[model samples]
Target: MFLLMSSNSHHWNLMAVASSSASPQEKYDVFLSFRGADTRNTFTSHLYAALCQKKINAFIDDEELKRGEQISPSLLNAIEQSKISLIIFSEGYASSRWCLEELEKILECKNSYGQIVIPVFYGVYPSDVRNQTGTFGKVFDELEKDRQEMLQRWRTALREAANLSGFDSDVIK
Candidate 1:
């Protein structure tokens, strides 16, 4: 049975269980976040390969979770335990409310647990993330019109995330 834990406390998931046989050095060093439909086979794949080549353990989602499905407690615990979070901000990322919530949680870890957040501006400008321009701006505008409080929370998260050190896709290649 999948256990759903409160957002206020740490949720544990059986799927995320670490092996007792594995040493501490075998643990993943980074948790990668990206919109799979946007750049899964290209940029994200390459980045993951490179990190693996360098011996950096990285975790990335292979399947998209449906909206309204509970995010597994194991996944949340994995994100919290990772030493670094590499967020690949594609154009459509902010449009998904789920991704936005994941981003918010990552930011929470950043502030409270000192997890490092490294944003990768994939096909979008860093300014766009900072200011919520283009598609991102449109999404936020609509959310603000319909849900003021939620929009405020999202805006605060976006602002904090934008301040993190990042690289554009062009620079990466």
Candidate 2:
């Protein structure tokens, strides 16, 4: 990124800020977020494998986290330490409260810490996520029956995340 600075002599000077420069070091280069049951065996596994083959530091949760409970401290720390987050939004993604919680934290890191987030709409559409249409909308309706406040957070997070430019699996081929 280049910045323009105004000088005392009424002339503007250009300053270069390279966005690609590597930082000192981080625990992980990328953190994976997805509905494990949906893509764990197919697209996500392939993605994790490819990232490993290229020697990229990626984090894939080793143990499955159950829903509507205290999240592991380590997972929260992982989100803070990673340089990038890859959120794989599948058909049933919003159904998992745990996934919604993770998405909230990921977006928080994005706003407060500048952690990059890349949303992947796998077997779904970005508009569906942003608008909470289709399965996403259905899930929220269920969540609204009880956890209304938490559900609202999830909806806002999805809307913000889906607003970003990301890859569509259907368009890959």
Candidate 3:
């Protein structure tokens, strides 16, 4: 199965469904986690369209629903209900509190419910995501000191998600 992000053409497509089998109890085939400003209009949107064409039910949050400081209960619930999660780790992924929160929940679901996690390293190196180096490392300095515990969780999640086998946009196209 391939999640092809054609760099030259700036189009994305899920080249193949990893597995035809799906759990009957699951509400969705996939859950998308991404930084809105980084990929909402381009990569994520095109990927979602590809999933839809394959008749894969996926959950992608609307911009209006992300107006709060905390992640929504429904968004977390969607992660739990999905059979798989495709985390598009872009250049600005770690900078967004929202994206970090979603990453944490996706990993939690993976550990607790056997939900599959496929990390797509888009434009950023997997090592940067794992070690929080380069651009991924900069966001930690700007966060409030009071958020240390939450920040630790985010870092742990990033490291864990980066370790999983998945796609890297830079090498693919």
Candidate 4:
């Protein structure tokens, strides 16, 4: 009877352990969000290479998703688990709806999860990002044509995000 009780207790403990165990997080050191056509082969590539050289685990999307397709759940999980997000605000960045959505996610993560957001103003001004000037303004104008409410949200997000500390590529050049 004592041996049977011990075996039952062991099984119960194993069941408890299995039930309580959580899956491992897909943590990343950095997540890079950029307009691939604008800078992927140049600045984005260089930045990714540099981060890799520094032994940082970085995620950058290299493939094109079909229209209406969602970003991979694994990649989204990685983004959520990343310590830092690097946003490359190039000329055509605001033109891409997918990039805008990714930017929104990064900003949301920063606000809710204490993640660090670093904006790289590549050939764009901080004021532009903050105030939606120039290309940023033009993109917002286009967005406002069909989705005024959503554009407002994006504007607020862009303004708040631009306030975060970052590097200006023009200054580096």
User: How high is the CA lDDT of each candidate model?
Assistant: 0.71, 0.79, 0.82, 0.73
Per residue, candidate 3 scores C-alpha lDDT tens digits across 80-167 of 8898899999988887888888998899889987898999998999999999998877764566669899889988999999999988
Worst 10 residues of 1 by lDDT: 1-10
- State which candidate has the highest lDDT: 3
Task: Write candidate 4's Cα lDDT for 40-138 as tens digits.
Answer: 999888777766665667888888666577667766776787777888998777767777778888988888877778888888998998988898778
lDDT of 3 at 155: 84
Q: Give the root-mean-square deviation of each candidate in angstroms.
A: 10.7, 10.2, 2.9, 15.2
Best-first order by lDDT:
3, 2, 4, 1
Assess candidate 2 and give its TM-score to the true structure: 0.83
Clashing pairs in 4: none
lDDT, candidate 3, at 111: 94
In model 4, how large is the Cα lDDT of residue 81? 77
Write the number of the candidate with greater TM-score, choosing between 2 and 3: 3
lDDT of 3: 0.82
Worst ten in a row by lDDT for model 4: 1-10
Clashes of 2: 0
Q: Is candidate 2 or candidate 3 better by lDDT?
A: 3
Ten-residue segment with the worst summed lDDT in candidate 2?
A: 1-10
